[model samples]
Target: MQVLATAGHAAHGKSSLVRALTGMEPKEPGPALTGTAWTRLPSGRRVAFVDVPGDPRSVPAVLAGLAPAPAVLLAVAADEGWMPQSREHLEAAVALGVRSGVLAITRADVADPGIALRQARERLAGTPLAAAEAVAVSTVTGTGTAELAAALDRLTGRLPVPDPDAPVRLWVDHAFTAGRQSVVSGTLGAGTVRVDDELVLMPAGTRVRVRTIGCAGEPRDEVGGVSRVVLTLRDAGPVAPGMALVAPGRWSPTTSVDVRTRFGEASGRLARRMTLHIGAAAVRVGLRPLGPDTARLTLNARLALHVGDTGVLRDPDRRAIAGVSVLDVRPPTLVRRGAGAARARELASWPDRPDGALVLRRHGVLRRAELTGMGCAVPPDAVPLNGDWVADPAHWETLRDRLAAETARHAAERPGAPGLPLETVRLRLGLPARELVAALARPPLRIEGGDQLAGGQPEPEADGLQ
Candidate 1:
């Protein structure tokens, strides 16, 4: 089903328009009584309509509905033209990546729609919906309702289908108890859930069994992503609206995250405390600046997060401050003095592929198998050092060069001093680990006996030094 959210200013006839579009048929399935509704097209296609409040104060609700819907129906009042709330809603929609939508000019009977249409186009100019189709309609007189429906069909028809095999994340927007069973409803993001499948509730590791799944008021054995689902859970405990039902062992709930952030056009330097909204969860967090556009957020509650999930950060006053892109869900603690700067560098150099090269580059050396266990692909060019350790090719070369120079200097200064003690060479290079020293023991530099390093040419007097 294609989900279309109605976004516009308050009193713009958004809810009235959705009722008109869906005919408010009590017999129809889906969320017809609330802000969300659904209707069947002539082609027998069902399109879900999410009617968002037009008031600026309702921005959070609009954002919550927009999280799972890919398309929108931006409603504009014919007489009022584009209000301040309209612009804010549009900006929020665009920032949230809702680009596909149609413009609905309601209450056209009260004013000439030609002027409103022109004004709507002007407001949408240079925005994501610059080319969106606009139509004038009246719920009372029913003017242009057919055109609006056709436009909605076109928009929903063009929406991309959700992948069923992807990772599953269902953002719970509503939770209640029904007949001794706990019910939760939301748009499933990916993967499929079947009856009797155990789903893990995030932030708290509570596992609940799926008793039944319903869509459009019909029971189903399984449901896939990109669809609205109402789930009745068995043996569940205190289910709530900000929680998520996810496949077990696939995600981790984390309190601290390192993110790449982009400040909004109206955003200022973020405050120490802010509200972070991801999926349907909103929680306060402490912001630690890692860079100008990056931060380490310490969430008040753990959230089941993954890399690439986009969230919005708002100040305590509920003003949007920045858009956050998850770079690392499991961020390291900035415990040391310069760890923040060092962490920034490490995240800056993160590669697209989890190839062990970046990890090795950052850590100097790691156990080959351990790198793979961290979801890193060991590059084919990587060479094995010692028994199970691996070192990046380039890093090992640099280490080799530094060790040769340091060893040669130590030998030259002492004339015939026994090849520098392995411990001394290790200490001089500032590498405290024996594995780090072993990584530099490749060709052109040899370990003399078991305790000394021969940098360049070996002296005859130094042969028996060990």
Candidate 2:
């Protein structure tokens, strides 16, 4: 299923449009500032609205939280022309690979509609957005609501679709309390999620019971197909936005990844090391160019990114300039000098043993925390030294014993640290991908205070990170 996101400058009539489109108010209570609102609209239509803060810092969270390949709605006020924040949202959307969208020129009665349209065209010129159509709308007058909804229905076909029989997975973009239980809201990416379906929260993989599923504010038994859903989870714990409530036996967090990213006109040359933001997770990656169409990079920090996940590249200031989609995911060792045999051999021995520094030269499925919990300890190193105590045959037997002991000890003692990134461990071990992963399944040791891991924490609140 596709996760559609609504983003524009503040007060572009997005909240009203969302209500008209889905008939649900994601903007809860009191007066609405519309700061990154997400909801599962009525009729199994899942829409996540990032009501941007109009503040410059909020742009990163809006762009980063966006579901990959989801439909985008660039709402512009007809009377307001192209405001500063509006342009920022537009560029961020374009960077995320949003091609098909319906431009809603709101406040038509209050302002000149044509002027806004012209400004939007100018801002989006030379991009795919220039070719798409627009629908004029007014929340007060109730004008053009039907036309915009129809256009959205047509655009839904382009968003990603998951197998209906596949396990359910959703990025919890919004979480709040309705009454007695914790509720999570986001676009359903795939499969059918129904009332009382048992679910698992990833990294921790804790069991959560489902009490009800609300689609577009109405209680329902089931929902799918680009629909928004608010699920009352039994074991909500500290679950928040960016957390994936996935069907059992379906979710895999990546440690190494092969991604394809496109730089924007304003983007400078992507350097060797940078940070990547996806959903609610962020990590600094060591970037390596493979070709014009491909890239081989390592996450300096850690995350369980997946194949087909959307990620945005940002500068140190946290400003996003480009977005990427994962094409492949493997072990942290895959961040090899080349995607070759030698790299594989070196990374294979990594997991179960201690190391000085681990680097995910590429992004892959294994979660960094789980990987690290496998008895691997990392020494202080700003970069993934790719150091391995087991690399030498003499040290192999000793390291092997340590790996076994660590995995059993940690699995029983700590269970798992959802906060630890698997990438951090892989890079720290500097072991071959195969070895590092095997230990991840049943880690070799327990991890205490993180002395060396970076980018291991998955900050769910994008606003807080800002």
Candidate 3:
């Protein structure tokens, strides 16, 4: 199954287009109706249309609809070629990285769709949807609807294949009680979800089991990525919008993140406070600019975020929106005078994709599992030292040299004392475990006994009298 969201101004036939394509009446516009409508095209491919409201007040709902969708069905009315909400919706789509879609000139029977199509193309120029196919449709006369459907079929066919085995991160756009059970629905961005799979709810960390799975209004044993899904959950306490269900033990819910702007320079110009909209979740955040294109966001609440996650930052006071790409979820604190600028320099060197080696280089050493939990993909060739701990080769060499120098100093300070206690050496070197000290021991530095380390040749034992 494929999913596409409807983005356009209100009363611009967004709902009418959905009704024509899916043959189902859209639910009243709200945060809960993000991905409720579905249809199957002539090519035998199932597609779900998320009809989002275009009201300026409902910008959050529009963001929720576009967050997880891979493509869009951008609607523009012939009579009203382009509008304010149309630009806003298009900006939201570009911010969320939506690249595949169809431009539908709706209500063509009332006016010349040629003008609307040309206007939309002019606005879409240089955006991800710049080359999107356009179809002029008139639901009143049932004209061009078939062509629109065919265009959508082609759009879905061109969508990038999703990884079914990737980690699941389903953003809950709607949650409600069905009879005695709790039901939640959202678009599955990646990975597959099964009936008995256990998932952890983000920001709350509540564990829940999937009692049932439904997709496209039909019950199923499991469903894969890039599809709209409904799950009846057990132990789903306080499930609501803006929360996410992710693979248990695989995500880190963080309150602070470093991001790169997709729209414009964020340095010293954006509001100090803004609301971050990502995957149906919206939360207040404090912004601290790190560079012209980079900034740190301190969210009011924790969010299960990863590297490369895209979202929009809206300044409520000015109603300004900026697209952001998350760079680091576990960002370092900027308490020193020049730390922020130095961090900006560091971030400037980072690639858009997650890099485990880069993470290890920054921290010196980290547990392999901790790195992965931070949404980093640990390289297969990474060598682990002292069990799960992986150290950067250069950092580890520096630590080894420091260890040798510290051991020699300890021996020189106490000529007759047993070489520094293993725990003491570990503490002096700021090593997390004493095992690392042993791992760092070289030819001249060796463990004297089970609990002590010797830095030099051992003193000769006094010969005993016969």
Once model 1 is optimally superposed onto the true structure by TM-score, how far is the C-alpha of residue 464 displaced, in angstroms? 32
- 36-69 per-residue lDDT for model 3 (tens digits): 6888998999998888988888898899989999
> What TM value does model 2 have?
0.62
Give me the runs in candidate 3 sitting further than 4 Å from their true place. Answer: 28-35, 178-180, 421-424, 447-451, 456-466
Instruction: Report the error of model 1 at residue 367, Å.
Output: 12
- Deviation (Å) of 228 in candidate 1: 1.0
Model-by-model lDDT, in order? 0.74, 0.59, 0.86
Candidate 1's displacement at residue 3, Å, is 1.5
lDDT per residue for candidate 1 within 1-466, as digits (tens), equals 6777778888998888888988763222223223557788756778777676666666666677776678778888888888887877777667666778999999999998888789889988987789998889998999989999988888777778887876678888778765567888877767788999988887787988999998766799998867777898876878777788887756657888777764373222678788887887888898888766678889999887666677778673856546677776656668899998888776766532334565566656667655543445566778677677777787777777787678668767888677777888778766646556755765556777887776564322347658
Higher-ranked by TM-score: 1 or 3? 3
- By summed lDDT, the worst window of 10 consecutive residues in model 2 runs over 452-461
Each model's Cα RMSD: 6.9, 15.3, 5.0
lDDT of 3 at 91: 89
Return the candidate ranking by TM-score, descending: 3, 1, 2
Candidate 2 per-residue lDDT, tens place, 35-110, comes to 3334332335545554434556565457544544366777899978888778767767776667777789999879
